[model samples]
Target: MLLISRENRELLRIIEEQKPSSLKELEAATGRKRSNLYRTLSTMAQYGIVDLVRSNKRVKPVVKATSFQVEFGLDEPSQHEKRRS
Candidate 1:
C-alpha cells in the first residue's frame, strides 16, 4: 500500500511550521538539529512533496503537498495502485 512514513510526517510538520520561512529559523523553533532537518528536507524534496526555493550560504526550501489532505494510511491499494501491485 502507498503510505507516508514517520519521517515524512515530521518533515511535513516542520514545513508547515517553517513555511513562508527558513530552515535555520525552523531549527530554532522546532528544536530539530541542522543535520536532521537537512536530511528530511532532502528526502522530502526527492518525493516532490517539498521544493527548494534558493541555494546559497543558506538553503531556503519550501514545502508543497500533493494535497492539503493527502492520504496517509495502510489500507488496501486503490484500483490504480492495485494494477501496479
Candidate 2:
C-alpha cells in the first residue's frame, strides 16, 4: 500500500480543488510558506503525483493524482509508516 501524509493529501486537495495558477497563490490558499511548500511539492513530483510547471519566474503546482489505493504487502511498513519511525 502507498499512502500519502495527511498534510500532503491536503496540499493535493487544495491544488485540485482551487487550481491555483502559481505557488504564491497556493501558499496563500494553504497558509504555508512558499519555501516549505516548494520542498514538499518537489517531493510529491518525484512520485509523479504532482507536476510543477514553471513559467517565467512563477512555479505552478498541478495535482496529477486525486485518489490512491492499496495493494497487498508482505511485511514491510508503508513509506508513510516508515517516516513516522
Leading candidate by TM-score:
2
Report the poorest 10 consecutive residues by lDDT, candidate 1.
1-10
Q: Cα lDDT for residue 68, model 1?
A: 47
lDDT per residue as tens, model 2, 1-85 = 1238788788899899999999999999999999988988888889888999999999999998887776887798889999999
Could you give candidate 1's per-residue lDDT for residues 19-82 as a string of tens digits?
A: 6366787678667787877787787677787886765667776867845455577786888998
lDDT of model 2, residue 1: 17
RMSD per model, one decimal? 5.9, 5.9
For model 1 the TM-score comes to: 0.58
| Global lDDT scores for all candidate models | 0.69, 0.88
How many collisions per candidate?
Answer: 0, 0
